[model samples]
Target: MNTSLKLKLGLLVFLLVLSVVTIVPSFYSATPDWWKKYMAPEGLRLGLDLQGGMHLVLKVDLKKAEENSLELAANDLKDTLSEQSVSAIRTPSVSPDTVIFTLPNTSSIEQVKKLVAEDFPDIDTKIESQEGSFPRIILTLKDAKKDYIKKHSVDQSLEIIRNRIDQFGVAEPVIIRQGEDEIVIQLPGVKDPKRAMKLLGDTAQLEFKLVAEPAGLNLNELIEKAKKSGQWKDGEDLKKLNRALQNQLPSDTTISFEKEVDPQTKVERITPLLLENKTLMTGEMVKDAQVRIGGTFNEPYVSLDLTGRGGKVFGQLTEKNVGRRMAIVLDNNVRSAPVIRERILGGSAQISGTFTHEEASDLAIVLRVGALPAPVDIIQNMTVGASLGQDSINKGLTSGVFGTIMVIGF
Candidate 1:
């Protein structure tokens, strides 16, 4: 080869080698703590078909949300009438905020119309008289309220579901709202498919009750006794209680239930049990949560850092409830119900469990993400064994290498 040609050929060879080496390593670079081996080389999350795991399509129950919304509107109307001294009123039937019912001889159609128009004036009212029958006032939402309800109903539902899934201890889970009322959740490398399904399917609405004050009793001593006896069964009846407790609380305290909800009124009242704002302190308040170090040689523990608000809440709650058992409920199951020894205002907490390093890490991930946006229905679930995924990886690597060599030679 001529001297100049040789130099040019050498440079070309070096450039090709650099591309091959750099490209392959770039494809195999160490992933972030959140996006590890399970992630695709291109920074995109790999689908089940590519990496192999469970893929689920969840159809969110839109009808159920609508029904709940109307029930809320109806309850609001009942309360408004009761407060206004309207007697002999029955529970109203609702269709998206149109409350339909008859008042007894005490109230006339005009009086009811005026009542609704003045008090619950957000909705439209139509008063009609029936011969030999009591007059009726039909209250429905205005166009603006209807549009807002239609817009936010799905979004709120999705948020609650997302919160539940994030607490489920699934690593690298993908939950997305699909159509108007459908959700899709992808769990990668999950060993227990049923566990994932159960967690995602759960409606993990949380409540904080004033553990009814023991009369003239030593709270600290009683808490200690309860702790020793292990009487607080955190997981046993939460699901049952959640379902049965609906619509039972007083109107002022019932956050999730309403007798008459309308798109026009959008009367959403926070239950007394909930914080005044009706928002729960979430895991996003956690800056970071990781496995703790330096216990027994192989012992596992989880350490957490809370955001400012979370730190304040955790600190205050722990301070006042010292010696009392506070249940750390995730997805409505008591993950840990440790006795608060003192205020944990330092924005950090440590939870010790009989877990492996991997298990502790997984739990940290679960607690860190907090909750999902909506309830997810797992329409499909498939578990691929580790060996199967490995086989696919082998085949994929072989095909890639063969194609590369063929391209080079040709």
Candidate 2:
């Protein structure tokens, strides 16, 4: 061959070799160690529709998020009233988008209205007439504000889910918001779909609250009351529990459960505990979290390191409430409530529960990524197995071989 022809042939051979090198990893699961070290490591990433994985459609509970917002607003109003020295005759009642409260006097109602107008711009306050002598006020979240919270909750949930998937070490995950309140997630090559689902579905909201010292109402009796009301079952119906305890609970206190399952009998037991409703800190203030083995039991647990502001607040909380029980709550379940022996000064804390290694790791991942703004329900879950993926690869390879032969012959 002439020099020019020889150069062209060499270039063609080089291009062919490069293409094969780039594509071989996708076909073979295991390559030579030297090849991995020397050659490019990345392979072609296929989607769930091609490579076979998990497909999930999660529906964001935007209405529940609105209720959560209302609850927070009600708490803030209570704090505002306390700060302004306006005594409330009753605890604020929070619905999905409204807060109802009764003031001691009509003079305090105007002050409360002014505070709501100045501090809570999203709430519309109305005087709902006097009950006997106390003035009743109802604060409803504005329609625009509710819509905004719902929209923002979806966006925040999407980001948090994406972060979690990325941390879970998926090569390439397809996470996108669908419509107004739905999220579509495609996880390729996930070996454990059930675990992945659990990780994704967890809201991971963490809170620190003080367990009420003088818990007046009996929690067991309260659980019986909840069961009689037909609103609670096996500690799952938190809203119903709240409703059942509405009249019995103290003004500043609420109830949550600590869930435990017996390994031998597989029976689930829930121990209810009274907790202060005011949240001293949240997972948003967490800087880092990791799974660690406990020294005494050798069991897996999560270690938390808080941010600067979180450290300050936590320190103050511990300092003021020395010898009091502080509850570590996750997704409304009380994980652990230990007495504050001394001020926890350095922002470090531990959450110990009956967790396997995998569960502890997943919890750390979610806490590190931060909590989802709202809860998500898995409306659709479909798992595609490796056999399906292999079939797809076989068909693709057959088509490619035929096309190559035709091109060469042509």
Candidate 3:
């Protein structure tokens, strides 16, 4: 061979070797340990349509999202009033589109109306029914505001779900808004469809609220009554129970369930707890969450780091609420209720519970990814089997090999 041809042949051999090295890992499940150290551990992955995986269509609960948005706006409005020294007769009560509250006098009502007009222009204030001498001011979200909330909610859920799936190690997940209030997700090569679904659909809304302990507020007795009466269904039991509890306990408090997993038997139990409706801090303030191994018995737990503002607020909350139990709630289920001993500063918190390492890791992933903007309801679920993928691979290889031989022979 000439010098140039020799160089070309050498380059071809080197290319073949490199290709073999890269392909071997993907070609075999039992790859050599040295290949992992020297080359990429994982090869280029096939997409869901090619490799077979789970396909899901989810609908965002826009109504529930709207109600949640209303509640948050109401809470913020209530805080603003307190900050401005404009006292409402009670905390702002939220409807689907309205925030209703009463002021003790015309002065307070005017202040609130002015505040809404100036700061909350998207909100329209109406002086409605009266409680004795006080006037009930209704704050309704504007059409434009409602539209924005709806759009932002779907977009927000899309991004949060994408982030979560990315953290879940899914290589090429197709997460897109399907329609006005629906999302489509295709997760490729997912062996555990149930776990993926849980990770994607779980709202993971985390809130820290003070445990409401009132005189004669027997939560156990209330739960017993609920159990005795099978009239309530569809998780509407919670709404009815809360309404009943409000007749006895403070309106600012509601009943929540604490999920406890027995370490020895690995059985799950739910215990009722009365928690303040006011959320002192939310998962929005969480800067990071990690799974840590610690404890007297060395258990896995999710530890949290908070933002600066969140840290300050948490410190203040713990300081003011010392000797009272603060409930760490996720998705309406209380994880732990620890009495504030002193000020828990440093923006750090540990969610210690009876959970396995995998569960703790998943918890950390969701917490780190932050809560979903809204909950998702699955409309369709399809599992793609691996046989199709194997068939595709076989056909592709046969065609490729046959074409290569034909080219060389011709």
Q: Give the number of the best model, judged by TM-score.
A: 2
Tens-place lDDT per residue, model 2, 1-410, is 79999999999999999988887777776878667566747768877767778989999998888877777787788877988898765444544456678887777877888888888998888896655767888877889988898769988999999999998999889898899999999999898988999999999999999998563667888778778877787637686677767777777678888777664566877777889888988898899999998655688899999999989998999999999999999998899898999988998899987888999999999999988878899999989777766787789889999999999999
lDDT of 1 at 402: 100
lDDT of 1: 0.55
Q: List candidate 3 segments past 4 Å from native.
A: 1-14, 36-42, 83-95, 129-133, 229-237, 265-267
Sort all candidates by TM-score, best to worst.
Answer: 2, 3, 1
Candidate 1 residue lDDT tens string, 1-410? 79999999999999877655444533465535444444323343444655567778776655454444444455567656666666423333534446665676534556666766676645677766667877666666667665565567667656655665566545567777777766677777666676566555654433222222234534334333444665433334432332333343232222111122222455633211211111224455777778886555456678878878878877887777778655444443334445678887788766664555766765665555544433446676666545666577679879999998999899
- Clashes (backbone N, CA, C under 3 Å), per candidate, total 30, 0, 0
The true-versus-predicted C-alpha distance at residue 153 of model 1, in Å, is 7.8
Residue 25 of model 3: what lDDT?
70
Error of 2 at 228 (Å): 5.6
User: Per-residue lDDT of 29-86 in model 3, one digit per residue for the tens?
Assistant: 7987888667856675788867889999999888787777667877888889989887
Report lDDT (CA) for all predictions: 0.55, 0.85, 0.83
On the 0 to 100 scale, the lDDT of residue 378 in model 2 is 100
